[model samples]
Target chain A: MSDKKTITFPVEATHVMMFRRSIGDYAVPDTGLEKAAVPPTFPRAVAQFDPDYHLRLKPGEAWFGSGKKPSGVEGKPSSAGGLHAEQHFEFLRPMVPGDVLSVTEHVGKTWEKESKRAGKLVFTERVQEFRDQKGELVCISRGVSVRTERPVDQK
Target chain B: MRLKASQISVGDTFEDILVEDLKRTQLVMYSGTSGDYNPLHTDDIYCREAAGYPGVFAHGMLTMGMTGRVVTDRFGAENVKKYGVRFTNQVWPGDDLKGKAVVDAIRQENGETLIDMTITTTNQKGDVVLSGYATARAEK
Candidate 1:
């Protein structure tokens, strides 16, 4: 736990523009947004800057997404990468598109539960902190992920 | 618009229609932006043939992200000190969503006024897809 991995996220205006469009926030125009703040959920885009983010497809690595088959990687379990359970963000200051953030994530907590439909559910929590170049804390994001024993029963 | 403590009261509420008939393309767009390319959110074939489900569903983050507009619009993104949500149900394409924030309390913290509110996003069926709370600094 001592050697925590940190990713360098250089916030770009184009990335913020695309993120705003993706979230369908038209009112908060990206134009001149460098002087303003991004969406409250803007910190979630740090995944794009994490080189080892497992959810994204990496070159030379087999992805779980379908190509010729239902899954490109063999024996990939259903409900791959787990499901997002909860997310919480605390911002000391708004994230600006022009700020370079030093992001670090570490495991927080783990627990297990039993569900009739999904069977055993293992929940893992991760905490990510975004710090500006000045090393000042900008934001803290906490996300919980649940891994189901099987696909959730669509009842 | 900034939330003013003097102009607001507990039990007051504000809301917005987050999306009408949520589209799969939006999910793809989110993945493109957020770097979450999990097939469960964008790959229908993977959802049907590989994973046992109806089809591709929207990412929970997408719902959270979309629902966030209401908060930022009301509180101003800079004023939002804390925002959080729990995914209650799966969001599917064509599902319409509405987000609401109810004023739970207004109090003084650190000599500054703050607003605590409850956040909820519901689908067309009245099913809550996301529920949580938010705290924002309010203008006194």
Candidate 2:
């Protein structure tokens, strides 16, 4: 299984504003962000533009009850129930509307451990690197997803 | 809006900012905007009946994003170099949250001054829903 994928898209002011509003930053005067400057965590919002950006595993099957389904890969675990365990970001440069960002994502470390509640827990980390139209690095994001078996009652 | 590394002491802390109460409508808005249609976040019935959650809850990203404002509002967003968080607790509807960012350390690296900060967000019940750390370039 190829452990990497890439996608590119343009940033839109409207979408950035929607994200601002979604987080209840209603008082941020539109004029203050005239440059289309996005918030610190805005890169995550832009990632949704990728067509393949969906949880790979089903909620009921993963241990934490949620997880990203690995794409174009076989032999991946199918069990469900997981949670978004952790998130990390490195913003190397600012992003603005009209800028096209090329994002490359690759699976990082994957391992398993024993947990009392879920029995065996599987953890996966995915890293995404974002570059701008000028080919300058913009941001790097890491997301950790953990999968575990659901309790018998929840199943 | 850049903060001078020398001007900010290691113990300096930003005043707590109250985030808007968590609302179902806001969760739905985030679901639509982020394109994360996880039934656990938007469908109460599915969350309660299928996922075993008491009810639909706000996305952890939503809480992180809101808490991030504490940093960006004090220091420019462009100055932020690193930000991260761990989801410690679920935020339910009607829960009011407050966030505060404290300067943990200030140091010079690669000829640039940087400030390290620890961020914490708590619900009205005083439960720490989310906690994280951040690093940003400081001016002066």
Candidate 3:
């Protein structure tokens, strides 16, 4: 649990509802917020609270998605922000809507390997701890992102 | 409904079709909800010209999120204590996905019953896209 940065995430009911739909889980009703059963991977939604998160669009900054040209940024980014390699979650207790979480992220591990499909691969692990308002750990998320020397061979 | 230790066995398996003919709009929906605006998942032109991919691909987290239902449905989300996965292959726009969760072990810890399971998600061609494991509480 190396110290790094923290952000506050307010778990809202409507947002949870939307996330459920995004993942195609329709069996559970979105009406009951208090007793609503949240999905196990909901913690990753913490990205919303991270103001400087690289993937989201900022108000005035040039976005990398698309516009008149293939990209809005001044120059090519060489590669995409890498690919997701692994993700894991550990829950100490069920995290429900209405619980404000204080989320913190720390750099975990980094390594490199040679790959035939994508050339050289550099992997970095980011660990996040979600804590309730009471300062109790609600969940722990570990994610690994990888950057390849070149685009993966489609064949 | 929570899995019952009395009713389930180590080899018992559960499966679900996570998605069929996956649409680009589905990828956009995931990007919107997940706050991940990575063009590799939604922007065709950017991916083709810049990233060098054929086109957009699904976020690994999106696939992980969908694969989770196979486990959560059986044990209930609240009962799950651990869930994790590795992205084995990329998922494309028109690909169909199916996920399976197989019970691997059941044990008693501190008088509480728990089940460990192995997870696998495969595309239409039988290529494994995601693989991982989960542990959840069971009714004693």
Candidate 4:
């Protein structure tokens, strides 16, 4: 494939069963981050590996390619460390509070597509495996992401 | 009573789950968040006139996610060992969807209880939309 890249990101134990429940101790509503109806799961997903939040989007931020602006993945490997496509979370086991989790990711596939405005849309497929503290496979999330030329506003 | 595969006969039927009047907005919101921009879901005109569907349809993931909700709510998250399914039919918008899970078989090994469950989603007319199975651990 012309101009293709691949990448992977790991999900953490603490993040596997994490959710901003509409009701609960960890309840986090949509506060200027996302539409009120779209509860953000980023906190739970990213907290597993990146604690410091370095280079990771905060809650309510978009994953994959930002429709309006450049996602800022330049000169970096397609994996972009933790960049993901659509994460398919297969809940083999339910993770509860205080249950630790860990995830390992690998870029399984990569390809490229031609888009009218974005020129060449480079896509990467990432597969992430989640495990509990005991190292039991808990979930598998597959994601697809597209990369393209930076928009004028972003560049 | 503890829910186990042995307790549930293979022909035994589980409770029927129904979601009434799925809104078009629900499908739209799911599309926006899930990044599945398939015209079959959001484009009403395409769904009705072009695709021959009654209207826009719901994402299979939304229905699957709801099933996950049922499993988590029934057995609690910790008891779930693994959950997966393959979509077999399209769930159109505004159709009352019903879900039924049956006990396919039960097996225990080394103190671990594995209950094989078969899940089916059907339209209000009783037309099957999706069907699959789930494996869960029994609590000791």
Candidate 5:
């Protein structure tokens, strides 16, 4: 828990716009999108999380485990920093194209634990909030990331 | 059966999202719907011992679906702009889950209105089981 940080970044309407465009690609009966007569929108409320939004990172940022690859097991290590999870939103009140959407992020907590394969595991939680043109809370998001050490059995 | 968004005001709350009982049928259907097949939600014996439950519990999504029913009731499906939520806690079977949403904020532009909601789900014990925010287009 000692290595915790807090950071914030402003996300705009375009961020929301991108998520709406891509979420459908992930849609399948598995996530419950099968029976719809037409593909549903990501809902304007969740437009802020385009996932494609270039992750705003700070200097000296180090990632741990390899991340997910578009293809398979040979892809990037996902948890070098940690396994990332997110919650997204589309503002009921538009963030509008030019509005300064303040995104405040904080590395609230981090912890480590033993792992059967990787030997050790570290996890981090990041919280982000976006505010709209009126200085009102537009969206709140939490990201959880997990990283694991190399397998003890590895050569 | 339904309440128009205009009929509600800031601080006003709606009736509970009623379900007779958290039957296995609903949970099974929900697992199929949500793709969350955690054994704790389906296997009664495993839930009672490993998960420390009296019996199987309802999927958080089922409770969320109940909450969505509230949104569908208030704004109808067409006007709902977004519906996203986190599963804050759990709801077990036989729990009387009630959902209520209060208008927390509102904005208008070009005659279009969007309302923010502080939506909550609670058991009969009045303990909040799930909590999240929702936004919808206000009817003209």
Candidate 6:
């Protein structure tokens, strides 16, 4: 089954400024970018508008298991502990303010592994592709989240 | 800053970046901006009592984002073709992270110049927190 969904949002300058400031890129030369161009890695801000944005907000939920209800997993706690294992990005074009991005995300991979501390670890990969208003590919992002069988405290 | 394709060699190096110290306010702003509100990153009480962490830590993406500046500052953002990273260690508040990107190879493919690079970010203790590679098109 394909767990695919599409999200659309305009790149806002205010959010871009906030992201730049948050990362401490304050010395960016004022090349009149307050109106158009955005900082590098700005496309990642799209997560703010995801409908399931709340899924990643909780600390108790496993980073991999967040978003899906605990009922989805059998013989395990509703929320487990996990980590953000990896991230990859491919940028095809520069993203600027006012450009509306249509992002589509779907499950990419699922696997298991044996670990000394966490016991067995389950990993889930999600890939998000962003296209411009003209349907031209702009960026591709892949995120890997791994969930453990037991909590950190239990380990 | 733009560099000609011919000017970049296997040993070429981009300017190193001294990242600002990780701060609590920066973590909160990142959570709000990136929508990654994991309590281990933003809430101190939850980190201590529930997560059993020393304290709130910066998001991995935040460190990645800061490390990326080394590339965008030298090659321009639009030039980036691929970037990937492996999280090696945690970044704590007050830690001063330093990032360096070195050219690993320069190849010509399909009439386009491609520059490959290896990136590493280390904290004040000289411990590597993140390491990865990136590929970008050269302006020349």
Listed models, DockQ each? 0.85, 0.43, 0.84, 0.09, 0.06, 0.47
Best prediction by lDDT: 3
lDDT of 3 by residue, A1-155 (tens): 23677899888877878888899887767673545678998888888878888888889998887889888876654466888999999999999888999999889899999999888999999999999999999999999999998899987
> What lDDT does the true structure give each of the candidates?
0.87, 0.73, 0.88, 0.50, 0.50, 0.74
Ranking by DockQ: 1, 3, 6, 2, 4, 5
Name the runs in model 5 displaced over 4 angstroms.
Answer: A1-155, B1-6, B49-53, B84-88
Q: Which pairs of residues have clashing backbones in candidate 3?
A: none
Return the top candidate by DockQ: 1
For model 3, how does the per-residue alpha-carbon lDDT over B1-140 read when each residue is reduced to its tens digit? 45677988989988899999999999999998888889899889999987788999999989999998888887788888999999999999999999999999999988988999999999999999999999988876
**What is candidate 6's CAPRI-style docking category based on DockQ?**
acceptable
Ten residues in a row with the worst lDDT in model 5 chain A?
Answer: A36-45
lDDT for position B45 in model 2: 57
- The better candidate by TM-score, 5 or 6, is 6
lDDT of 2 at A88: 91
What would the per-residue lDDT of candidate 6 be over residues A1-155, giving only the tens digit for each residue? 13677888688777777777777777544453566345556666787788677435444544422133322234434223357767889888777777899998889899999877556878898888889989999889888887766543321
Can you tell me which runs of candidate 6 are displaced by over 4 Å?
Answer: A29-40, A55-81, A149-155
lDDT rank, highest first?
A: 3, 1, 6, 2, 5, 4
For candidate 2, write residues B3-84 as lDDT tens digits: 6666789888885555656679999898777766666677665565555567778888888888888887666677788999
Interface RMSD of 4: 10.9
Count of backbone clashes for each model?
0, 15, 0, 12, 29, 0
Residue-level lDDT tens digits of model 5 in B24-131: 766765554333444445666544433334566665546655665566556654465555565545577676777788788777756778777877778777887767
Q: Report the Cα lDDT for residue B127, model 6.
A: 92
Displacement of the residue A142 alpha carbon in candidate 3, Å:
0.6
**What TM-score, to 2 decimals, does candidate 4 have?**
0.52
